[model samples]
Target chain A: MEQYEKIYLYKRIVKAKLFIDDHYAENIDLGNICDQANFSRFHFIRLFKSIYGSTPNNYLIKTRMEKAKILLAKGHSVLETSIMVGFDSPTSFAGMFKRIAGQTPSSFQKKQHAQKNAMQLNPLLFVPNCFAENNGWTK
Target chain B: MITKITHTCIYVLDQNSAYDFYVNKLGFKVHTDAPMGEGARWLTVTPPEQPELEITLFLVAEGGMFDEETVQIMTTLIKKGTFGAAVFTCKDLLATYEELKSKGVVFKKPPTKEFYGYEALFLDDSGNWFSLAQINS
Candidate 1:
């Protein structure tokens, strides 16, 4: 491919990725993503996988799960989080979350809640020792 | 007095991947790509709009340019993402940020309004981060 063509292709591929980044909360699929990039399904999958190192569906699921993690950490219930991140069923959400995050939704939320409470109790305890000492905060 | 600084170096973990990141992702053009004996390459690239400056993509291999210990330490430091080597200016911070992010550039910061300018930070393939800024003039 010519240099300009390569640049154009990359711009299109990046556009598809940005679309996924923006609309991961929506019901997105291979067709929607490929439309954003102007590529056919199989060819788009090839290009997207080569560049981003994951298929579009996997990337979409990962994106939603990542946002779900933040929402879960912020004390949102698993059912609510699943809905928020566009998951239809909490069971599927919990299953996928466990697969990707290595813990059940409730357990992760509990850990985050415990950590938040502990931090609130002694804010300094959560601060890294080196970071505190760097500004003479330890002394 | 020196007329201009033409060349600089960024120590990379793997030269081929760095080439892909710089040329394919960042739209830099390869200025020089050649072998310097013993399976090492003397590779350099230039930003698309700035051909005058050659950014040498020096490989951190333990052979001719460095010893085994030095290579180990350098790789460790680069992997830790410690270096902030250069500042690249862009016309529009937000657009460039989005564009680069799509190309898999790992950004450390989103564009924010600092006193000096609107600046964001991103890491290259080999873990050397850069400051992408749009100065308020």
Candidate 2:
């Protein structure tokens, strides 16, 4: 009985997380997330952190940042990537990206483009810049 | 010396659900999905990066190796989470844990540092749990 209820709660929490993942591009907030799990904000935050190792808000930002990184790597403009990742303004997105990703979106995008060209130049080598550095393929 | 092992078996209550959980959710690749004799499905999935090893998803029905009584016992045990099937490793345990948790995988334990390494326990669709680990390199 107790175990069955526990599994049910877990399923609800997972559903909420998946909701955030699928709707990260939309204008969703913590209330929308907690509603999916049928829990109040405080309880949801505790359970979510316990299960996922990060609070729901933090998880949402991480997801958004991850998506922004992908968009920027694909040569999207910083403003465009910010909007696509659900940031209200490019300036705020730039600030948050720097805090979370440790570099401005524009600088990261530039680095990615350079890395792409470098990889193409060494077509046969076929390794990421970090991997190449670790392997001493680059000095 | 023995070269390498090719296959491992995990007894699942339902092959269809296992297929969904392993292939769809966990992102494993289906190596084989042919039907076996007597309504049994011979499904096997390989981890995305490790294509050489096939994990066989065996159905725990009252056919082939299992009789009716055995099937009943097995079903009870599996639902009760009696099996610790295997330990699966990843490059980053915490990231993988979060990813899998979001994919609806029910975790029995969160990631923790143990004497061997950092590991978390998660249940499959059929209640079979596995230890997900990230060993120090």
Candidate 3:
């Protein structure tokens, strides 16, 4: 496994996490993920957990579920939503959904849509460019 | 000699959302989208002005870092949203804060005095924390 001071190693782990985020929906597997972070299959898992506190699969599942919720709210059918998130079967998606989201996909989607009105930032919000003025030149 | 830190990573449930948040909202430039065999993607980010430097984001679940046991632990923290932090050097901390706030970036804490200089904290869409600071040149 690669070694750096804790700080330097952490920065590398972060870089890997970013890669996962950009392509989670695109059929990711373990070997490729480990390679991206420049770690072996054995070591990458431990270091990634130490740094980001989650296994790669869980992150991928959660990401898929999150997207599933959004698609459901948009009125996509349960089966469609299931496939959209990469689950081959709606049953599998439902089972996973129950485990993670605590409710059936349809129910969650119904509840979400029932909310009074959708605000521009209702689902989620990002930190605005509050630091633009201070952002200095790149190193 | 090693150059300054070029890239940083943040775990995300899905990469598309991460891309939207970082590129669309945070205004980071996408530096790399290399392919790792087996359907995985390698993504990176950098300040718009410094396109050459890139930070890669890896997708690891709670205990999935190295194997199943670890994935359990790591996924928990990642789901709860407490993992790591990204530090950005700023020329003027105050101005950056105001600009980010205007763009709808949420801040956990306002800028405050620190040994390094003025600093502020914010969270990305993935619940990863980041710091913005103005350091002496």
**Residue-level error in angstroms, candidate 2, position B80:** 28
Q: B1-137 in candidate 3: lDDT tens per residue?
A: 98675555576766787888787767676655544334455567777557766666665533213466666666677767586566877655654565567557878888888986888998777677788887855
DockQ for the candidates, in order:
0.05, 0.04, 0.03
User: Which order, best to worst by DockQ?
Assistant: 1, 2, 3
Tens-place lDDT per residue, model 1, B7-40, is 7889899998999999878868766564433565
Candidate 3 whole-model C-alpha lDDT, 0 to 1:
0.66
Per-residue lDDT for A35-95 in model 2, tens only? 9999989999998988677899999999899789778977999989989999899999999
Residue-by-residue lDDT tens digits, candidate 2, B41-93: 55678886798888988788764467899999999999999999998887667
CA lDDT, every model vs. true structure? 0.81, 0.81, 0.66
Model 3 spans > 4 angstroms off? A1-8, A116-139, B1-137
True contacts preserved, each candidate? 0.06, 0.00, 0.00
Best by DockQ: 1
Model 2 clashing residue pairs (backbone): none
Model 2 segments beyond 4 Å from truth?
A127-139, B1-137
- Write one digit per residue (lDDT tens) for candidate 3, span A1-139: 3433643555456556656666765667887677787888878888766544578767777768867876887789999888877787899999999899899998898786664133222311111122111221111
- As for DockQ, the candidate ahead, 2 or 3, is 2
